[model samples]
Target: MNNFQQTARVGLFFILGLALTWVTFETLRGGKVFKDQGYNLIAGFTTLKELKDGDEVRMAGVKIGEVERTRLAGRRAEAVLRIDHRVRIKSDAAATIVMAGLIGTNYISIDLGTDAAPDLPDGAEIKTQATADLNSVMSQIGDLGKKLETAIGDLSGALSGGKDGKTGIIAKVDLLITENRENIGKATANLQEITAKVNKGEGTLGRLINDPKLHDELVTTLDEIKKGAGEAKNFIANAQKIVDQVKAGQGAIGALVFDQKAGEDVKASIANLRAVSDKIARGEGTLGKLLSDESLFRDAQSIMKKADRALDGLDDTGPITAVGVVYQGLF
Candidate 1:
């Protein structure tokens, strides 16, 4: 009976150990033992960035799967993700390794692609994007700090002078001031003298500033200029009105320029005048004959001499006989 009790006790202890081991394995596997392990998808990355097996795979901050394993393929690394079968990952969905916090473990972050996109097939590779991990960022920051330190040292050297006995900016400036001290003093003295003269109204500028009469005259001149400008504006307005009237065909000049009938009449008159002038030049009309024929001039001269003789005869005769004598002489 004692041997049987000891054997039973050993058996109970072995069973207890197996139970504990099973429970620990189930917990680590997320209690998915004897259940559907889901489909696998490959995610390729330049680096896993501390990702390991059992790390959560999240979509929009919600865990939908976990990393099954990580392996290197040629020059790059890839993670095998075991995704829940119910959660369909679209073909266009991208995966990225993201950190939860500065000290938190990294996870696989996925984006919800468009609803119209087809689901990615099992065992197919999921798209991955490179992200700046904490280590890389820290390393970049360190490099930047070193570069900044070097730059600052260079600036310090430039400002404070180099080790080769070169003069710095401050030293050069001091030397310049020392060399030009007398000139600077003269310039300052001249400025003071000019200011004193201006205060005493000794020059044109001084008078313009300190003389009330000059100020009043300047104001009066300004007022005159304003009045002149106003008159000029009114003149321009009147000129513009005249121009508008002309443009509207309201004046003589406008009629001459824009009235077709008036233009035609003027053209006709000019044509008629030209015709008459041509006739005169050709000696074709009475005026033309009078102007161009020597015979008519000679006849007029003869008639004037007969009239003179008849008038002399009339002076010796009675009034009734004077008419007869004038007529007989002209006949």
Candidate 2:
């Protein structure tokens, strides 16, 4: 019976030792006893962003593998992923480091590539993309906060009109009001006077404002002006129509201006007129000589004087005697 008890105690101790060994192995191996028997894929990135080995490799939020190791390759860092053999990753699959939470661990996340793409081979290099680090995000937020604070301070300063200069909006407005105070007072007085006049129905403007009949008359005048504008528009349209017809070679003026034969004829007539004008200027024609000759003018004046003396003698003499006398005078 004692031998049996000792044997049972030895068996219990062996089982306890085996359980402790399993627990330690599970802890060291990230809860998986058998090292992930799968294909390895390489992913390179500028930064790992706190991604460590044994971290989950997820596809669409489902754990599909684990990050096997991380090592520096030349200037860049590379992560080796052990993907489950059952899960087929396409060659175009991209891997990126993702934070589980704001203060949580980081992991490898992958997008499910299209099925049309070929399956990636073992030991293939998967594409990697860098994500914004928490530190960088915090730094950018601090910078943006500072800029916003500056803008708010500037706005407050502008509204309060800081005494630095006349650059603030409130300061400029106050300066303008101070300079125009007298003008503003005059304007206010004028407005009050105009209001009194309007109430009493004084001037044409006041009457128009106070009396419906005058308002109606003004409306009628405005309607007449509108009618006149319409008539002017119609006149302009008619003029435009005429211009368009001329442009289209549809009118007599258009034909004279656009037709080659009519233009040639006009040119020939102009040439003839120019030639005649030139001849006249040079005293080449009868009319030209009549206008230009001084001898003809003197002869005309002498003839007129002789004719007057003959006519005067004729008035006092008999017809035959007058004729003889005129003949004797001419000779």
Candidate 3:
């Protein structure tokens, strides 16, 4: 009875050990014991971002598949995804490896592609994109920190003007004061004297400030200026009104300036004047003939000479002889 009991105890211990080993294996392999009920698709990327087998594949924060396997094919690395058969992944869907958190595990992430696109077939390659790595980000941050430190050091050196012969604000100000001390003293003394004279009412500016009569005169002058300004404003308003009237073609000047019909009439009158002048130049009218002919002057001169001769004959002869001579001359 004792020997039989010992053999049974050993068998029970062996079975317990086997169960523990199986549990550990399942835990390490992501706990998927049964066959995955899904079709496979391949995804290729420059890097998998620490993605491994048995990682969950999610679409829109929901788990729809798992990464079945990963492999290095030629130059690029690839991950085979086992997607749920019921979940339709579009042909244009993209896949990427993303971290769950800063220190959490990485997983394959699928995007919900457009509904109009066809479903991705089994064994088809899904598109992939490379993500920013944490290590690279940390390295960039360190480099930025170093650069910022350098800039701050440079700014400090400029402000403090380190003892290495570099000029700074403080050094320049001290030098300026040292060089102009005598001029500054003279300016201060002159300012004091001018202020004393002003207090004593010894100049025109002082009288302007302290004398009541001058103040009243200044006020009167200012009032006159204000009155003039009002008149100027009225003049400007009248000028603006005239301009508006001109723009509206309301007066003769406005009509000549803004009225199209008036301008056309003026142009027509100018053309008529030109035509008349041309006619006159060609001796085609009465005025043109009067200006161009010389026969009228000759006829007037002959009449004048006959009248003189007739007058002389009247003075020398008797009444009947004078009448006969005048008749002959007239004829």
Clashing pairs in 2: none
For model 3, residues 1-331, the per-residue Cα lDDT tens digits are 6998999999999999998888888767754566566899999998887889889999999999888889999888999998988898998889888899788589988999999999998999988878888888999999999999999988877776878634876677777888999999999999999888878887998888888899999999999999999999999999999999999999998999999999999999999999989988887787776666667567667878997899899888968798888887788
Name model 1 segments beyond 4 Å from true: 1-21, 29-37, 192-331
lDDT of 2 by residue, 59-145 (tens): 999999888888999999998998998999988889999999888599999999998999999999998788898999999999999
Stronger candidate by TM-score (1 vs 3): 1
Q: Number of clashes in every candidate structure? A: 0, 0, 0
Please provide, for model 1 over 238-277, each residue's C-alpha lDDT reduced to its tens digit, 9 standing for 90 to 100.
Answer: 9999898888899898898889999999999999999999
Location of the lowest summed lDDT over 10 successive residues in candidate 1 = 29-38
- Candidate numbers, best TM-score first, in rank order: 2, 1, 3
* TM-score against native, each model: 0.59, 0.63, 0.59
Superior by lDDT: candidate 1 or candidate 2: 1
Best candidate, lDDT: 1
